[model samples]
Target: MSLRLHRIQRFVLSVLLFSSLVCVSCKSSEKITREVDPTVEAYSIDEDKAIDRLSEAIQHKTVSLEDTTEIVYDQYDDFIAFLEKRYPHLHQKVEKQRIGKYSVLYKWEGNESNLKPAMLIGHYDVVPVSSGSDTLWTYSPYKGAVDEGFVWGRGTLDDKSGIMSIMEAGEYLAEQNFNPDRTIYVALHHDEEVGGVRGAQRIAEHLQDKGVELAYLVDEGLPIAEEIIENVEVPLAMIGIASKGSVNIELAYNQDGGHSSMPPRSSVIGTLSNAVNRIERKPMKASYRGLIVETFDPLIPYMTYTQRLAFNNTWLFRRIIKNKLSNNPATNAALRTTAAKTIFEAGFKENVLPVEGRVIINFRIHPNDTVEDVVEYVRDRIRNDRINIQVLDRARNSSPVSSTKAMPYKMLKRTIEESFGEVLVSPSLFIAASDARHFHDLTSNIYRFRPIRARHEDRSRIHGIDERISTENYIEMIRFQIRLIENGAAEL
Candidate 1:
């Protein structure tokens, strides 16, 4: 009996030891912290004047339309004239050239001519307010109203702020007689809202023809995301190292038109609806690879205990995590190639069945997938020979992933750290298309980030109503741009 008791005790001790080991292993490893320097001088600008300038920029109705011919050229011309008049110093210092008909490129010559230059790009074009939604706006979309400590207007958020901030930084620096070690090019595209086919594409081609090698290209993308990850409420400054590709697939089916009273079996509308349902039910596969993994790896330590446990042991919890992420629309977009049936057409009259049914599905391709891969997957999923599939408009594959080890990335990260103290920084995949796509051939190093403090509430405000930026956030953007410019010129 004593021998039996001893064996039981040994077994209990072994269990206790194993449990303790598991607990220790599951805890977060080591915390990494970045030191904020007290000696680093903070850049300041005229807050009132800056706000006024951004307000004025918003007043110009430089809206980009899907149909290029519908764009108001006079508005763009007026906007350009406004910039020239307002930033007299910048206009005099930088050699400015208009690319295509509306886009403008400004080159600031650095003292060190041999070094490859860095480029800062943003589009002046803003998406037009949806028709019949004008009554919903608190302020007129084009009025550029400054009230309640926010600049309210159409371009206030989805990127006139970026353009104004960069220009503000340059104008301020130029006035200070500050010269950089590397040249800087500012490309302001007017057609980024409509695919940038005319604006950014032309600028990139012109630069390529001139044999200008860029050290890095910075464009508008991921902002300083607040409360991005659940349970980790700390703001994350996400730098987009790559952007997702976009493709529109058209699924069309034609059938003989007949009276609604004697509807034939498997009508075109019915067939098309079934195909869409099938595609939606079985979406593109989600994987924990590429940017999704890269983004979460560094953030694991900052996550909650349960989240840390799951993320730390991706091998066991990957399926669970993927499912959880896939359930949420925002996280799902980050994980897989998302498909949305944007446009659907069928019968025009109530009593008549239409002969043709057309559905336009847009897919934002993940970096792991290609345009062809997306198309093939849709074709195979539908499995209907009668339903014809065709690529619509322009289709672009994902941009090549930029290296995190490059100096430009490091410089950009460091500048962010210095500007916004103690914020977590990580590389993220941009799920939307940007003008940076045009610059992929010009340089391997392209970083997409705009230093705006964005919260979940700001998401809808971007292209939706009441688009505005807080006065303080606007100042932060200017300071970030200033630091980025200075960092680009600093010694490696």
Candidate 2:
């Protein structure tokens, strides 16, 4: 009987020991995860000062255009002087260079050799403000006033924010006396709103000539948004990994001129219009099997169980995913290449039948696709040999995929993760063009990320009236930029 009791006691002791071990293991894991700095605390940004600076920037009215006939009120010179005044500390420390009449470049020399440098790019130029719409604005377009959490004006969101953030960070680093290992270049182009012939492209050419192969280039593209992820509303910081290539094709057809009463079987206007209709009907197929879809896979773990299951079932999810993306204009843009018909010309006068008519198409090509493929696809769709297709301009596809593995991207993600707290960081393809294209050959990895939270109303103001960024987001943006430069510089 005593022996039997000993056996029972030994078995109970064994079970208790196993249970204790399991509890300890789980506690250790939970503790380690809690220690990891996934979410950065939110700090109050200096909203008033940020708005004042943004407002002052908008007041300059630096309209970029191809017409070299300068506007009498053109304020490029004044803008340069403003930068010199605002960032006096930066001016004293960093090496600054002025390219042409307006473009600016700054270098913070590092300890390493000058083989590969990481470049942070932004432009100061803004599109001309549309006239005769004073009442459309809640505040004057140039007023830069902070009302209801936003700093309103032109260039507030487009790019001046990028320039401000970089300078703010540089100034802070100088104060901290922090030095990076690799050389860093801050290139600001003067003509991004217009084509970048004299501004960014020329800058890239000069850098290439100087044998400066860039480690990576960071530019402007996507923004951070709160409470919206796959319709679930999580904070998301979208970094643009690549921009689609652009091609302009002009289609023209000729018909013999004649009196309006006596017309040919098919007029030039009719044929041109028919070609456009056909091209539109047979739109480019949207495909999601690429780097873009892959980037979002990491976020699946953070989603709800239903969402996780939906994400996991690739076979069941493909059709639903495509449909969901097609439903939203913004999501559609991020997933596919887009074709827009910008200009069309047909008749010289109403009374006469024109001899020639032309239509121009602008295509934003996806990274997996090429300009040749786009043109060929359009040519095949139109199928009318009488229509002449001529290429106007083509900005060739960039080489790098803007890897998340790169030091700058990792630093950006880490900084954002700390600052925004709960936001998920993901990369996508940016539809519009930016100055980053010029640095494709020089920089191996390039991305576009502005760390600010924006909404539908904020996005509408981007080339429209009362364009503004949140005063709070603006200050945090500056802090994030300072952190990125400081963090990225350390690895160099």
Which has the greatest lDDT? 1
**Model 2 C-alpha lDDT per residue in residues 21-104, reported as the tens digit of each score:** 665332211111222142222323455655676778878888776676865325888888888887777778788888766889
Per-residue accuracy of model 1 over 162-243 as CA lDDT, tens digit each: 9999999998888888888899999999999988989999999999999999999999988888767765666788899998
| Clash pairs, model 2 backbone | 40-418, 181-492, 227-233, 228-233
- Give the TM-score (vs. native) of candidate 1: 0.92
lDDT of 2 at 301: 65
Q: How many backbone clashes does candidate 1 have?
A: 0
Candidate 1 whole-model C-alpha lDDT, 0 to 1: 0.87
Superpose all Cα atoms of candidate 2 onto the true structure and report the RMSD in Å to 1 decimal.
11.5
